[model samples]
Target: MTKRSTPSSPQSRGNAPRKSGGGWPIPTPGDVLCYAYLWAREAAQGQEEGLKDRPVVVVLAATDTGNGVRLTVAPITHSAPDGAEGAVEVPLAVKRDLGLDRERSWIVVSEVNGFLWPGPDVRPLADGSPFYGAIPDWLFLRMREGIGVHAGRGRVRVTKRTE
Candidate 1:
């Protein structure tokens, strides 16, 4: 009979002592997610007006019971400045337009139409929540909401059904 080899240990598998890449390792998935979220939130607050012609990353939460998925602010790389209010929770009216009625759903923003709306109604995700809700400001952006296209990264793509 042939002999079987033993499986590798966590340490041997390079996963035992998970570090934040302080030096010996690299940032973890959790770290990236948190960083991306903060960056999006900050971007939303910097502008006095709504987002237009700006590319944003859409963040989708893995869990359904919690805050659920989120759409990141444009650029997907800008970090939120300290002392700045966290991303404004999405406004309520925006959610209704986007057809988000449940907590478990993907978030998305697109440019297939080639323009972002001037500004739309906004509402908070929840009471006292700092996260800003969706506000489609570009006309093209509005049309792209349900249009099919490969999302850049960190953004969610939802397709709207045509009757």
Candidate 2:
């Protein structure tokens, strides 16, 4: 667990959740959580879940019609931007603050996934912590802008989780 507001963390073995139990915290914008992010390509190929669990940044959160919070999140990966992919580098200080690996990482804004809060894809870290913690406001704003632009350009792909 992060020792923050949440009970614990999940990558879920790489993302893993059945449901939120025991007063599970609601996700907020700028939160970096380990999740099973089904990429657009995977969805196109008919794969329902992400290949592996990984850190993802919450870019948007809105109250769904069912009164559950629906979240739109982007992946954080070590891969550098190689082309038209919209991305923002994760500053070393930020990564250090979140207790993430030392490897260089980026928040990929061009791809995202949507799911209800504390859905089945959420997973705790092996130690049972629930998140890496939240990103800075400035960083999240930048990511949100990127997401908006990509989404407007039809470059963003949002895979809604089935479960």
Per TM-score, the best of the predicted structures is 2
For candidate 2, the C-alpha RMSD (Å) to the true structure equals 6.0
Poorly placed runs, candidate 1 (over 4 Å): 1-13, 16-20, 27-32, 39-44, 47-103, 107-163
lDDT of each: 0.26, 0.78
Candidate 2's residue-wise lDDT over 1-163, tens digit each?
A: 1223432234322233334443456666788888888889888999888888899998878879975888888999898887645799989988888889889999999888998888888877766655777888777777888888888898887788865
* Candidate 1 per-residue lDDT over residues 46-144, each given as its tens digit: 633334322232222222243322232322223332322212233345445433443322223332111111112111223321122233443224323
**Predicted structure 1, TM vs. truth:** 0.19
* Winner by lDDT: 2
TM-scores, in order shown? 0.19, 0.83
> Lowest lDDT 10-mer window, candidate 2?
6-15
| Candidate 2 positional error at 156, Å | 1.1
